[model samples]
Target: MTRSARRTRRTTRSLQVAGVSAAALLALSACSSSDDASSDSSSTPKSSSSPKLTGTVTVFAAASLKESFTSLGKEFEQAHPGTKVTFNFGGSDTLAASITGGAPADVFAAASPKTMAIVTDKKDAATTPATFVRNQLEIATLPGNPDKVSSLKDLTTSDLKVVLCDKTVPCGAAAQKALDASHLKLTPVSYEQDVKSALTKVELNEADAAVVYKTDVKAAGDKVEGVEFPESADAINDYPIALLKDAPNAEAATAFIALVQSPEGQKVLTAAGFLKPTA
Candidate 1:
């Protein structure tokens, strides 16, 4: 072969080798970059990208649970940054009616199992009702017991104006049970829709006495005096709580219910005169 032709062939071979090397380097660099990206993605926490508990958790609770549940609602809000707790406190029956009527609610805490059954029977409850606390009836009289009311029987006196919870309400039903157990009859001056209302009548001096839950009388502070009766043991109420089926904020409602049944919640409830649930 001629010298010029040989030189051209060597140069061409050298250029081909350089091109191959460059292509190999580019492939390695791209592979390294892909590996680095994969490692970074795996290192990130999965929970960080998950949706957080947010929005309002609406709870329908018996009037007697007003104080303790309100405190718990605040604690729940503090625990979850972007959450809110709202409550509908009233007669358990009334609350159940509202829930079954398509009212939007996330949770229900009824004063009695019977009242809770009103919702559960209609499949309004997403979960089985669990009794978290129990409440006993008490006679609430004016501060200092001006009427000298000491026992449940004292409220039965016709001369004294006594208020009672309506029969449909847990408080009134418990009171009636206690009365039946004692073989006695009480004719209240008025039948209030809830324990709070019955207690209020005595607090405002509109009535001489009222039969209400121990928790209600305790919540009334110095406005009323509580008298404990032996018959109350037979009529203690079981306060059941449940998650509603059509809950708009089921996630937060579940968390709130957990908080209510937690040890921290029991501390708040027992402090407010609510009896701890029996085994």
Candidate 2:
């Protein structure tokens, strides 16, 4: 153990310690760099997988669907948050025309297959139309049987003022078909533009009888009485529903469509007096 030898040994040991410390610092720096790189990668924007449907949905439906669609619209809003359902209720033909003409619409429910065909032809429909319900003609009169109009044959009487929808509307077309099948032609005082208007005339006691859907009579409550005629079966109009291609919120539109076809929707529609589709 000479002093120089001891000093050299100590100095060599210190150098080794310094080398080890430098290596440890380098290792820590590498690990820190790796963690930062990993953090950046993880934080990088990725395609979101969460499904969120938020927007406005516009529905164009036949005037006949007013009551049923109003309830369904409220239900849809409750089921989907951040969504507003705006309904445009009018004649099926008119609604189809509006939709096909580039009107913004999320869905459409028509009172007749023919009207639905118009949208399908224009490729405005997102999917195949499905029949949800059917409706038949009924003889609606004042609650007290003022006209005593009991049979289809009785409608031909010259004294009774009858109101009928124009051939353009579904009910009117059906009434025409039924009358043609029955070989009975009754003169109507006025050719109403739509079924509701035809029914409204009866409701207001403006006309003695109007050929309208049974559901319309029911929806009118006690304002009018419904007379079921056997010939009505010959002219049942099928109701159809479809999602529009220009839907603003696709997810919500799909969900709403599913809801309408569901059992709950069926029940709601039935409660509104709509008959289930046979097909």
Model 2 C-alpha lDDT per residue in residues 31-55, reported as the tens digit of each score:
9999999999999999878676678
Scored by lDDT, model 1 comes in at: 0.93
RMSD of every candidate to native, in Å, equals: 6.1, 6.1
TM-score of each: 0.84, 0.80
Which regions of candidate 2 fall more than 4 Å away from where they truly are? 1-50
lDDT of 1 by residue, 1-279 (tens): 999999999999999999999999999999999999999999987765656889999999999999999999999999899999999999999999999999999999999999999999999999999999999999998899888877878777889998889999999999999999998898888999998888888888899988898898889999999889999999999999999999999998999999999999999999999999999
Best model per TM-score: 1
| C-alpha lDDT values of all predictions | 0.93, 0.88
Supply candidate 1's per-residue lDDT for 104: 99
